[model samples]
Target chain A: MAVYTEVPDSALSAFLDAYDLGTLLSYKGIAEGVENTNFFLHTTAGNFILTLYEKRVNEADLPFFLNLMEHLARRGLACPQPVRNRQGEALGRLCGRPAVIVSFLDGVSVKVPGVDQCRALGQALAALHAAGRDFGMTRANSLSVSAWRPLFAQAEHQADSVSPGLAARTRADLDLLESAWPTGLPGGVIHADLFTDNVFFIGEDLSGLIDFYFACTDAFAYDLAICLNAWCFSPDGSFHRDRAAALIAGYEAVRPLEAAEVEALPILARGAALRFMLTRLVDWLNVPPGALVQPKDPREYDRRLTFHRQARDARDYGRA
Target chain B: MAVYTEVPDSALSAFLDAYDLGTLLSYKGIAEGVENTNFFLHTTAGNFILTLYEKRVNEADLPFFLNLMEHLARRGLACPQPVRNRQGEALGRLCGRPAVIVSFLDGVSVKVPGVDQCRALGQALAALHAAGRDFGMTRANSLSVSAWRPLFAQAEHQADSVSPGLAARTRADLDLLESAWPTGLPGGVIHADLFTDNVFFIGEDLSGLIDFYFACTDAFAYDLAICLNAWCFSPDGSFHRDRAAALIAGYEAVRPLEAAEVEALPILARGAALRFMLTRLVDWLNVPPGALVQPKDPREYDRRLTFHRQARDARDYGRA
Candidate 1:
């Protein structure tokens, strides 16, 4: 729905021309996303997704996103690898926008992922982090610890509308996070947006991961925090200790968290909640009418941030 | 940064000519939101926020939003009241978009809100819910329980690359929510997007609330669930039991939750989380590269949803 680009049919045809994906049978715009122009293309070769980079995407970062898929795919992560053109370029021009074609992965996103699924996601994430250790590319975490205040400052004038004492509370949290930021933890390319939709699965088995646009070089524990927030909670703002434990065990099995990282989970979760709350709050206030994109409710992240503010221990997640 | 429309000087002048806001000294765009084009306006009358409705906001709902603000303000809520023109019209054209002028409340949003502040917010929110009971306007909750699946289904295909088991899990959650949706709770106009940034405070005192774009007729308990998620969580996705208790107590102090409502908190929280996660997940796969709008990390809602799934007791929220 948020197709900001007008990728031409010719561009898609060109991609088909270059790639070894036999013949294109059909292409239809996937009408649900808020960012890129996505076309679900059915070809004699196989089903694939053609994504035209939309405005919010950085052209310069295309390689990292494209190559990360390739890198992960090579490591048997079951992700959709970018299809390279004849000139050996994964990036191409489609509908006048920067475009790439990826294999259409099969599987539904788990709406109510079980504890085992959460654990699998954790393990897969750890494996991805481990594999990213040598990806030879790096991007700064745009939504990292340092970006909170400035983002909040941008909305300070109307901050009262979001919550009473939000600005000050955020400032205090920022200070706390800054002073107590975990240092020297395991670091690598972190999938900053590992929500349920970004990961695919079949039944209890994990399938693949997608949407690495927010991938960045940050402390691996931050990724764990992201996962803890993503996978270990139910929809009603309650923490599932079992799921949390399963997820943590899964991650620790692959790449054990450092003592400092484990200790910082609560605070890190708080930071992550703030980061999302700020962004969502800003978005909520500025949703553009006529645009197909849906404005998210900022309160969701606000609740998560509130939860993290009181989170005292990892065991609080569940009976350890 | 996502200013959908630029309000020119002429548009402001025309608006001033129609409204009784005296003279407009200057107005400039505020670049903190992704939904509406907001301008900080200084007039002889007072400081105000000039908002041009952006996408995802329905034009038909303008009167409901404007009137609700006026109603709340009239009822002694310290929120921004929409200014009407001579024709008794609150809606107008600015920068080729639907626009309105709102009296900006004076106060700074505290970044580090204390327990007292949290309690105050809870009380204020309860007052807001109480105020909405007889506002003479009603609009269905756009993010109600029934809307979650269709929203997620819209973006389901695009999310395939994220995790292997995401799709099935999402389906499962949807099925569960559908089967377990609570029927017949107290219903009223709710500030569905009440995050910290939307609420303001003067020092430790409550100032006012703003941004009523997502206000709609929904179950009051659902709104509470939203606040519980927004106000009770830390940034890192852990539950803040104290704040949760403070907030719920504050809400109960004004308008107590029904026994059924208390019992349904878990599912309500799940529904709320699912509502947001679906929206964020949809946004995640859709963000365009060059748009001023930032893509929210869907993982944030994923964490909240995870929390809701495991929520067992209100005591876990510091509520007895």
Candidate 2:
């Protein structure tokens, strides 16, 4: 639950004055996202989401996040619509943090996503990639291949404490991914963090996608790989082949993958596991004495890394 | 922002199966309340609040909390109306904790409350006291006069750390309050914890009062005393005379306080200050290492207690 900032009532009142939203009736801090403070707000005008960008979000990237939502939403894609203030600006300041109010999307995220649910997410993701292809602005995926080494360095000394030899395996994986990471296969604004929680559905229909905090310009297939690791893996860390096939097939229906993209899946999947594992490891090691949130176990990704280490091809992930 | 427990997806799905609320469309952990896991739940039926009682709340007294909201709401009290399942039970279990779904109330809480807002809150609190006069079921105010000493005992050894002479002064005040604590004041279920955030408003109209987790059978005037301490204090700990007068007048306009209740106001206010002071001090001294919430500065109440210690009568609180 990502709510690190508290928006005081005075700050909220002054912030809303910049917009045409009627008197604020209710605002609740939503425990979603790991990088921003979100409030489920209801005003006399209507229901909306009030997001305050926190320390992790770059202030300069404000336009990118807001515009992407506006761009996708305007194109009939199911995502939040950024609400502009009376000045026609989507950005504002609240409680000394960058803030934006976006129209609320209507959908619930499935926990243990089924084969059909995975297919819906896959299609929604491909749709998101297509809609963001022409988004005009760009943000480099900060946690991509080149960034893994620095993240690993912070956790390297303590990594083995999480698991014996975990640091060495991670360092070796980072070296290989940096040297051999695929290039030039359909780069665009990808929902790089498309965890199941990021995708929302109303039964079989994918209603919307959220938490675009990690949305950045990266290989579209890398986004697909993240999903295979996030959505297709059972809790016990075993790969679910039918679910993976259904997901990839759903993506192919929207935007078919090139052969190079398919070939890069195994390595990309391993890189994705390593990236999450490194961050989780750092968070686990650095969690302050009284931190409110229990850090996600880095070992969960360690187990996933072990699986990806053995897969040699897209065939292992059941790509048809 | 109090979210103590996380209700998992499987648990939520299973819990909702017991409800007739159309389809579970969305449920996000809402950052509200200090003692329960509250989710802003949206389903095909409508929007509601899902609360899972945590350890701080006694399970045996849940029927009182749930039924009080029901009793108050039935009497036109603007509060969350507890939603009952098909079994006619307004209570259920979620994540192995006692849970209940309550109808959502509209209105936002003010930060720097003024005279008119205080008056509205005062009137509403009085109404709540009157409405709960015959609530049949009674729960003792666990933090009432008799309980403050033990709570103080837990923090007494560490109390001086909060202020130069706080621990010694607190012990002296406790002895005075205990020996002089008045009885024979009109008693009923009082909203013992009527802080600003617990009351919601639309413009100057009090739309609702919420968070009945602290409701209990206590002196009616004592509820007013808590409001005086809560709503009439400035950030620098100075009392706001106009707001205090407005609040008491609003209450008197509804259920007039008897002379004995009025005479007991100073001690009641002092006791209220100590009640909060003791809890905040314990929380301050014992906050777990990574606690998500910063404990309220016990010194805030320490300042209030200093004022109440010298207040001779209700007149000092702007009770004309």
Candidate 3:
């Protein structure tokens, strides 16, 4: 849960005056989005979400994120559509930050998703990749392979502080992955981070995909690899082969993976694990004292990296 | 924003199995309550709040808090009412802590309430006082005048660290207020903490009163005294005489204060300020490292004390 900035009473009143959303009933800062300050809004217009883009989000990228949601939403994806104000603009400024109101989408995000939920997530993700293939924007994945080293450098001195041999081992792994990282895999707009919390479901049915701040044009299989690492692994670091099988099959049902994509799975998964490790390491080490945010353990990715390092083939991931 | 405890997926799913509240769609830890971990839950049934009582809350008082909410809600307070499971029990255990689900209350808490809101808050608080007069359970005001000395002692060592000479002046103020604190002034069930955030408004109407954990048997006038400091003060520390007048008049419209209660207003207000100052001081000085909970500045209460210390009669509060 995160709400880094507070919208004061006068500010909120002024902010709502710009909108046509009936008389303001109530609004609250929701503990949902990590990268933005999100508020659950209830007005005569209906329930909606008011998001204040925080420092972690790039101001220039606001339109890209907004438009992508609009694009996917128009395609019938259940995502938060930016609510336009009287000026017919979806974006506005508040609390010295870029802010916007969006139609509230109702759905619960599952915690430990069941097998059917896993399958539904895979199908939904692959469909999202296909839907965004024609979007009229391009954002390079800033957290991809090319950016890992720089991210690692920021936290290099404190890496061993997290675990012994963590820094050196990560450096060597980075070198190996960088040298062997696949190029020319089929690329498209990928939901690079499809964790359970980002995908909402109404019971067994997928209701929506949210938090597209990490969306970018990347190897389609790389997105799948991120999911393989994110969704198909148990909390203890063991890969759930059956769940992996279900997820892969579900994705293949929507958009079949190329043979080259299959061949690149292990390396992509390893790279995915390391990418998260480096960023989480930097954030874990650099969290300002007394911050409300609790950084995820970089060690989890360490364990995933170990598992991916030993995998021999896609068969080990339940690839058919 | 605070959510000290996280509810795991397994634990949540298991917890919901006991209730018939539709399939879980989503659950998010809310940034509202400070004493407990509160999640805004959306299930097939509808919206509800799931609270995990933290260690800071005494477990034995769970029934009292829940029952008081029930009592007030039964008397038409728009507060959250505890939801019962199939076994007809509203309280259950989750994450090894006392947990319960309550129906969601709609309406927003204003950051800077207007005069109408001040009047609405005053009327609602007095109504709460009458409604909860017969609540079967009784909890002593833990932060009342008698408790201030011990709380001040806990925070005495580091009080100056908060502000220069804050310790000695607070000590002097506490001695005076505690001795002058009036007794036998029409005591009854009181919503001891009626801060703005605990009161909600929809337009000019008061929608709800919440956070009854601090509800206890105390002087009815003490509750009004807390509101005087809470509602009648501006962010810049100046008292709004008109708003205070409106609040007192609104309150007296529902339940007229006895002559003795009116005479005791200044001391009650002073004691109330010190009670909060001491608790907030102890919390501010003793916050655990990296605690998401930020303690309220005791100096704000110091400012309030400064105001109350000079007032010799209720007219200074714009008393009707």
Winner by lDDT: 2
**What is the C-alpha lDDT profile of model 2 across B1-320, one tens digit per residue?**
65677676778888888879988888888876767789999998888999988888899898999899999999889999988888899889887888999998887888789899988888898889889877889888889889988898888887887898998899899999999999989999988888988888876678899898998898998999999999999756788889999999999999889999999999999998889888989988997755656678888888988788789888999999
> What are the lDDT figures for the candidates, one per model?
0.76, 0.87, 0.86
**What is the alpha-carbon RMSD of candidate 2 to the true structure?**
1.8
Distance (Å) between predicted and true CA of B171, model 3? 3.3
* Pairs of residues clashing in candidate 2: A289-B289, A289-B290, A290-B289, A290-B290, A290-B291, A291-B290
TM-score of chain B of each: 0.95, 0.97, 0.97
Model 3 Cα shift for residue B301 (angstroms): 1.0
How do all the candidates rank in terms of lDDT, highest first? 2, 3, 1
Name the lDDT value of residue A296 in candidate 2: 84
Give lDDT tens digits, candidate 1, residues B1-320.
Answer: 44566454445666678888775543445544568877666566866788888877899999999999999999899899988889998889876678888886655454445677778988998899888777998888878877887898888887656545667778888999999899888778889988766777644677789889899988888887887777776655777778778888888888888888888788888788778778888877887654666676666666676677777856566677
Candidate 3 lDDT tens digits, A1-320: 68888888678888899999998877777876778899888788888889999889898888888899999998877788998999999999999989999888877777666778878878998888888888999889999998999999898898998999998999999999999999999997888988888887775688998888888889999999998888887667888888888888899999999899889999999999999888889888888866777888889888888899999889989988
Model 2 spans > 4 angstroms off: A288-292
Query: On residues A192-265, what C-alpha lDDT tens digit does candidate 1 reach at each position?
Result: 98987778765357878888888888989888888877777665677777888889888888888877777878
Best of the two (1, 2) by lDDT: 2
Residue B296 of candidate 2: its Cα lDDT?
Answer: 83
Q: How far off is residue B115 in model 2, in Å? A: 0.8
Q: Which runs in model 3 stand beyond 4 Å of their true positions?
A: none
